[model samples]
Structures are given as C-alpha cells and as structure tokens.
Target: MTTPYPRVELGDLPEIDVFSEEFRAAPWEVTSRIHSPNGLARSSRGIEGLTYQSAHTVLGDRRPRIGFDEMYQATGFDESSPVYQAAVTSINNLEGDVHKVLRETLGRYFTRDFVQTLRPVVRSIAEEILDGFVPGEPVDIATRLVGKIPSRLFASLVGAPLGDAEFLEKTSDALLTVFYMDNANHEVVEKAYAGLAAYVEDLIRVRQSSPGDDVVSYLLDVERSGRITRHDVIVNVTALLRASTDTTAGQMGLVIAELAERPDVWERCHSEPGIIPAAVMEAVRWRTGAWSILRVVREDMNILGTPVPAGTDFFGLAVAAHRDPEAYPDPHTFRLDRRRPKPTLNWGMGVHYCLGKPIAQVEMEEVVRLLTERWTGVHLAKPLVTDGEPVNSRPLTALIGHTPR
Candidate 1:
C-alpha cells in the first residue's frame, strides 16, 4: 500500500512562546502537531519525488543541476543553491584539517581543564555587563549583554583585535538574518556575505604575516603546509563565525528571558548553582536555537511506517521533539526541580550532533550560574520573540531590559 500522507496544519505547530505566563508555567500543555519521531515521518513523506528546500541543503546538494529555482521552489530561498562550489569544497576539505588544528592549537585553551580556569574570566564578563545596568531603563539585553559577550569571546578565541568586535557582530547578525529571517533582504545577505569574506581574507593575511596562539594562526600555518589553502581558511572562518556567534547568543538571550519570566525557576537556580547545567539543557530544549536539521535519505525505506523514497529530505524538528509530552512530563513548565529524566534533541542526535555541544554547555552554565548568583528581580521590558526568519518553527530571538536587584 502507498504511504498515507500525514495531514497536519502548520499553524497548529507548537511555537516557542515566552510571552504567555501560562506557557512559561506549563509549555507542554500546548501539544506539538509535529514532533521528532512523528515529524521525521511526516517530513519523509512530504519529500517523496519532491525536491528538498532549506538552508542545510545549500551545501549538501553538490551538483549545479540543483539550481536556484528548484531550490527556491523547494526551500524558499534562492541562495540555498550550492552556487558557491569553491567555497563549499574549501569548507569540506578544511573540516578535518580545522578539527585537528583546533585540537592542537586551541585545545589547551578550551579543554575541560582550561575551561575551568576561564570560569573566573566568564564571571568577570558577566559582572561587567551587570555593572552597566540601569535598573529602571529599558535595554536590549541581546545587544548589551548576551550578544556582546559571545562576540567578544569568539573574537578573542580567534585572536581578532578588540576593535573588530562590532564588525564581527554585525557580520554574524547579517549572516544569521540571511538564513533565519523570512524575506531576508537579498541586499543584506549579499552585503553581509561580501563584508564577512573581506574581513576573513584580511584576517588570514594578517595571521599569515604574524602568527599567534589562535585558530587563525593555526589556519595560516596549515595553509603554509599545503594541507589546506587560503580558500579553505576563509570559508571555514566564515562557518566558524556563523556557528559560534548566532546559536550561543540566541540561546543566551532565550535563557535570560526564561529566568525573567519564571522568577521561581530563577530562584531555584540561585539556591542551587549546580542545577545551572540542567537548567541550560532544559532552556535549550525549550527554545532550541537551531530549529531543525535536514538530512537526505540514502535509500528508500520506512520510518514510523512512512515510506520515504531515496534522496528524500527529512528534518529532525528538535524544538517540537523537546516539547513532546511523551518524553518530557509537563514539557512546557520551567520546573528546575522536575525529577523527570528526559533526553533533549536540542544538540541533535547521532553522528550529525553538534560538535560544539561541550563548549556551548560550558558557556551557558557559566552565564546562568553567574547571573543568578549576582542578580535578582530580572524581568523583560519587551516581548521575547524569535530572531531571523521563521522556518519550520520560530525560535526565541531576543530579550530586552533585565532589572537588577
């Protein structure tokens, strides 16, 4: 028998709603029409004989025959076409090289041992941000606190000069906007792409002339060894900036919003600092920085009784899955003390899982722990919503005006 197509309404999908007090207290009360297990099956069925559209496929579809029109028709964005083969090839070639170089070059700095050393540094940054807080006035926390810290940290990690922080943040935001926002202004995407490429090219040259103890220097060294090329360095650096900047910053903003809305949960974290990690994990599950990961079926097969054809596009909806009541009891509630043991698909699953999971966890844990310990009575001055464009589902975007005790 032919596969029965899953009929579902997109509007019925559970979105990340931080503004609803009811949602904050009990988010899982809202059922997700599509979730991990069932959503995967639904996506598999939808792509049968149809082209897959989305940002993730932009690089994976290696052939030119997979043109922009087809890509736009399937995915919504014309830029999703793998038009930048040179860039894509360079990135693929350098993935192994960069992973190794990161291990050798900055491994000492980011290791669990060294990360422990940075706790003081992380806390200092947190304090510095809080120091600038004006209790009664509205402030965009994303700009004032969350966005700035990660951008600075990422720049320092890459050995980019302090002056470049603003530029880096702008470029990262522009790039994220290109993918995340609906009707992403084409001009912004092109301008951002060009600006970032120029910046990376310039940085690569500087690092080549004067090597340092940073990832850029490592890339320069590898380029000199002929194992990787200049093209490889630039592309990988772009990917690094995109990955490092947006995801963490976005999640940080979401966590702040969560804490602000649920003072009880924030108090729980304050009383028990050790729960910061679990709180971060739950926040990620609740907001899920990256909404979905796209993968192509290698062969025709059945998943959740849905017949997926070969080359079909399947998406793992992490945000939906994380909210699944079957997995997380009272999935929507911000209950720090909940005894239910639930696995989050926020970082993804299987081999394609995020490589930066450890780093992200560490950064989040430190931020939450320090924020809770240092401040009280934090609340939002504006509505919290998803940034960029709304894709499979909107992810939490920004949080503004955090009051200090």
Candidate 2:
C-alpha cells in the first residue's frame, strides 16, 4: 500500500495559528473562516490519511497505539523512549479502565438522581456567587465566576478539600492549556505532573485512613478490593480533574458570552427557565470545548475514495464538523429552537468519546437554569466575538460587562 502523505500548500489553508493577535482579537470570525466548508477543505491538508472508512478502520472498538506513537513523535517525545511508553500505557489504561469503572464508581455521583438532588446546592452556590457580584461592575466572568463554580463543584464531587480545589484548578488550567496546544514546556509538564501526583497521593492516603461518600474515597475502596491499583487510581483521578475542570470552565464562559450577545436567547431562558438544558446542549455544539481528537490509520483504507495508509495521523476536527452546513443548516446562526440535534460528536464519535459527557451536560444545564432563574435582562458590556485562533470552538477571552435586570 502507498504511504498516504499527500502534499498540499500549507499556507493556502487558514493557519491554525493559535497565538496570533488577530485570532485573539476576533476568534469567532477566525473559527467561522477556518471551519467554513471551503475552509475545512483547505484545512484538509495531509488528508490522504483520512478515508471514508477511516473512522472505523482507524478508530475502531479497540484503542490503537499508532496514534499515540505519532503524537509522541510530533510532540518530540520519542515513542521508543521508556518515559513515552509509560505515559502512553498509562493513558490507554486509564481510558479503558475509567470508562468501565465510571458506571460502578462514579455513576452515583453524576447520576440524574444525584444531580437533581444536588440542584439546590448548585443553585445556592450560584446565588452566593452572583450575590457577591457587584452589579454594573465589568468582571472577568470567565476567570471569576465561570472557572470557580465548576472547579469547586468538581472538587466537592471528588472530595478534595476546598483549599486544594483552588490549587488543583490552577494546575489543571495550566496543564490543559499546555496539553491543548501540544506546546507544554518540559518544565511546565513536569511541574504539573509532579504537583498533581503529589496531591493525588496525599488524597489517596487520607481517603484510605478515613473513607467518605465522595469519589476519591470510593476509588480508594475499589483499589483496596483489587479492582484497581494505586497507579490506576492516580491516573483516573488525574484524568477526572483535568477533564472536568478546564472543559467545563471553558464551556461555561462560552455559553455565558453567547447568551450575553444574544439577549433573545438569554431572555427566553430567563422567562421560561426550562429551556436551559437545550440551550446548554446547543452551546456545547457551538463551542465544543475539546477541539480535535487525533487518531492513526491502523491499516490501508479508503474514505470517500480518499486513501489512508497505516500509521498515518488522522484528525477529527469536532468544532469544524459541528459547523458542517450539511449537518446543520445555516450553521453559523445560533438558534435555541433548532430542533435539538443529536448530541454533536462534540464529545466524540467512537469508543474513545469523552467519559464525562453526562456530568458535563448536567452541570451546564444546572448552571444555565440557575442563572436564568436568578436574573433578567442580562446584557453584555461588550460585543462578544470569537477572538482567537480556533482552538476548541473559541477560547472565550473577555466579557467586558453584564447586568441583572
């Protein structure tokens, strides 16, 4: 089989230049430009590796190592190196084991029953935060409110102490920022890994001595039962915090920004209060916190007649796919009434789909519902725009102002 390294002019495609000032100034426009059907076509450089059947052949039921190896290589981590191998093994093991254990271990914490039970607590927290918001003040809602709520909620869910929650949130954000761009410096990754490892190690010991109803405690119990090892516990806990904090915080900011820009949607939610769940899902489809999932072609394949060679890198751009006009008519416009489409592959399509989707949906729905019920005539202080290179949807930078009617 021919190696499918099809060559194309890279500069013709809107560069995925994440750090450009123009991108930072007008992210949504850049996103729209990059994700346009034509833009997507241009962005399809090195796509000789993406065949129609590529999804199945490349990202099948079982996890493949070729993608991990390629990612390591692209990131300058040697695939043959012991550290890279260990990290890959840890990642793969965590993905599979966490999914399986999620039902038994974390299912209760995030279940509909539990979420409904926690609604009052979540609302109380929301109100407390809003009550403290000096009305008419231009707040960095993203950093102040959006990031705080989810981090605290997640920490409570995992039984991490409140103080440590703040530290974990900061570390998680830095780690995610680095990971998302694949630009994490060695020191940054090392520090994050070390800090998180130390924190989890301490939590595991504490939970061992005094088990609680929270997830960490439960996972410790599971480890004791030989269902998982100490290393498994650490990897899964690290995954949970990383997955829960950054994405949720990012989505919260994006949704708030979206609502701020579209007063009609905000007013609808404020008036009805029941449509927030649908709105949250719509926002998720629009923002898509995690941008792309990388896969590797496992064998020779053909996707829509596009040839894919074994071991070639494949990228499924979730944000771009969500905006496909064929998938959603006039995809640019945000419509709450847009017949709640099936959960966009925003989370993912196949076996490697995000494990925390249910929890995220619940958290988003709760936050939106609470915000709508508590405020009216919520208005934006500045025009909300996607101002940055398209990294997962838009990196909702600044919300100049907001008010409660």
Candidate 3:
C-alpha cells in the first residue's frame, strides 16, 4: 500500500506465530498475549486484526482480494486439471463484480422460503439418525450420528437418494482439503472432483427429466435462461453441495459437544426451545478459533495505521474477533443471553459471506432442539479430538461420549 499518511510498518508491531500448533489448539493462549493499541498485529506472512472493529474493517473492506489461486499455484498442479478448475472457479476465490453476480444469483436461491423448505427435511433426517443412538451407550456420537446429518441433508437438497449421502460426504471431505494444501493430494482431489462431477451430471440429467422444487432445479432454470452456462451450474452446484456437506456437519458436532460440556445450558435448551437458536450461535463463536482469508493488496495501504507493503501476504482474522473482549463481553464465558454489539464473522463479513448459512442453521437448531428433547442426560464420555488447524479446525472432529438419563 502506497498511502500518503504516516504509517507504522508491520515489522514495527508485535508478532505472533499464528500457524503454530499452540495457537491452533488454543488460540486464546496466543491472542490473549496481543497488546497492540490499534488491534492489529503482525504474523509471519501478514497482519491479523484481533479486535472486532479492526477485523470487521479489514474483512468488510472490498479492496483486498482473496488469493486462493496463488495457493493453488504453489502446489505446482496443472491449472487445467479438474481439481484446479473446481478450486479456482469456487465463489470463495472470486471478487468484485464477477463475484457479486454469482453471489447474488446463488443468494436468490437461498431465500427464507427455500430454507423453510428444508425444515421438515432437517427434522426427518435428525430423527432418523437419532434412532441409531442407544440411550445407555458410550459412543462417538460426533462420527456415528452428528456428522451424517448434513450429508443426508445434502442428498435432500439435490434430490439424490439418501443412501448416496455417504459418497457425497467422502468426496466433499477430499475436495475441502483444497484449503488445507499441506494435507492435499492432487491425485485424490482430482479423483474426488471427477466423482462429484459425474454425480452432479447424472443428478442434473435426472432433475431435467423429473423436475422438482429443489436447488438444482432452480439453478437449471438459471442455466436455461442464458444467465449461467450448463457448465457453470454443474461446477457451482457441486460447490454448493460441498458447502452443505462438511462444514455444517462439523459445526453441528461441535455444537453438541459444547452443549454437553455445559449441562446447565443444555438443560435450558431442553426446557426452553426458544433458546436453541441463540445457543447454537454462541457455540459457533465460543468453539471457533482464529481463521483468515488470504488477501491481495492491489496497492500499498495503511490498515488501522499499520503500513502493509503491496506484495505482502495480508489476511482478515474473523475468528479471533469472536473472542475480542471488546466485541463479545466476557467473551470466554459461553453465555447464550449475552448481547452482541456486532454481527458474528463466522460466515464472513463482506461479499463472500456464506450463502448456505440458513440451511446450516436449520440443521443445527433442529438437531440440537430434538436431541435435548429426546435425551435426558447427555455428557461427554471423553475429550474432543480436533484437527487443530486454526483457520479450519473441527472442534468436534472426534467426539466420544456417554448419554445417560
């Protein structure tokens, strides 16, 4: 950034090694040490905005571009390959007017009416999956029960057979490793992409013949209207399915795990159905860790008075903001009734905020509400095992617990 105003270089600020395991496992341990006056601090590659105001300013600003392609290129993978094509074309990587068009078009389908359509689907799936859990058993409910909920919902979204939900879940898991490049194998990703494409292609054909009031049918209408191509519908719809599969399931597991730890809160949810929504959102914030979007600085700029060079790696840290004492009063205390001065950045802040959030919430709220109602006492059998990747941590990656009445 080439700003005319006097600036404080990032090097002049305190630095935190945000990528370390310590930070990933317990982010507050790292963020708690930060004492920057402007709420912005330096990490190895970029600057992190710790406070709600600073994080919101950086994340909400439309100037900084998300640079997933740069990460893709670092893999030395073929740009024209299936994996590369899908990753680069994802709505997450695009910006400006092109991004706005796809976002708005997709947003059109994710309306309240569409989400309301999923209510019964969420309930039926949740009830059916809950039937698999025995009341007196000590079990890894996160894997055995909660994780399967979203994949099943994904099946409902595209009008696919419920049995195929596992396949969709597996493919979505591999494709999501695109963001976790270190764990990614291009061959596996390519295969996953090819499999998803074939599934989507077949699904598209079926929907064409037997049209229903589903997301795919709506997207097909857009394609037919000449606004987006058939190829666009296929890729974008595949992205949408991926969104529905992993994150929703993982977060739902985390929510259950969190509620288990707080029996008092869990009891409130069991008795007061209206509190389920707030409880679900609070779990999202409390269980979250620091995560940033890689941003491209088109010109030299001063962020919160810190001078960041044009070529530097810049990011907007949203998760960290969730714990900012200034933003969330008594941030560490998991209180559902607490007031929120600002919108939670979990779905992000600007143009790329998650479009699938409504459906995800439906699944979470319904699952939590139903579980609390059906089971009398649900507590953890053991501790949660997380992937511990700060930006993409699954707090309930492995949950083993006992549910005793």
Which candidate achieves the best TM-score against the true structure?
A: 3
Q: Write the per-residue lDDT of candidate 1 for residues 1-405, one digit (tens) a residue.
A: 123435333333323332345533333342243242223323212321111112222213322111222222332344343323323343222234554553344343456765565566656666777788876566667667787776777787688876687888888877655443345454565667678888877887788788897778876776777866676667767766876777778777777777677787788888988888778777777766655544555466554334545665554445555666556777667666667555565454443345556776777788888778766757776576654322323324344555455
Tell me the lDDT of candidate 3.
0.76
Error of 2 at 35 (Å): 14
Worst 10 residues of 1 by lDDT: 48-57
lDDT of 2 by residue, 1-405 (tens): 222434333333334543456644543345556532123222333431112123233344354432544444444557665334434554333355554664455555556677666666666656777788887677767777777877787777777766676887887775555344363454565467678878888988888888888878877877788866777677767767776787777777787776766678878887877788777777776766655556655676543234435655455555555665656677777877777575575465565566667666766777777767655645556655442434454445555465556
The global C-alpha lDDT for each of the candidates, from Candidate 1 onward, is 0.57, 0.60, 0.76
- Model 3: ten consecutive residues of lowest lDDT: 1-10
Model 2: CA > 4 A from native: 1-45, 48-87, 90-109, 180-184, 383-387, 393-396
Candidate 2 to truth, TM: 0.79
Off by over 4 Å in 3: 1-6, 396-405
User: Scored by Cα lDDT, where does model 1 land?
Assistant: 0.57
Error of 2 at 66 (Å): 9.1
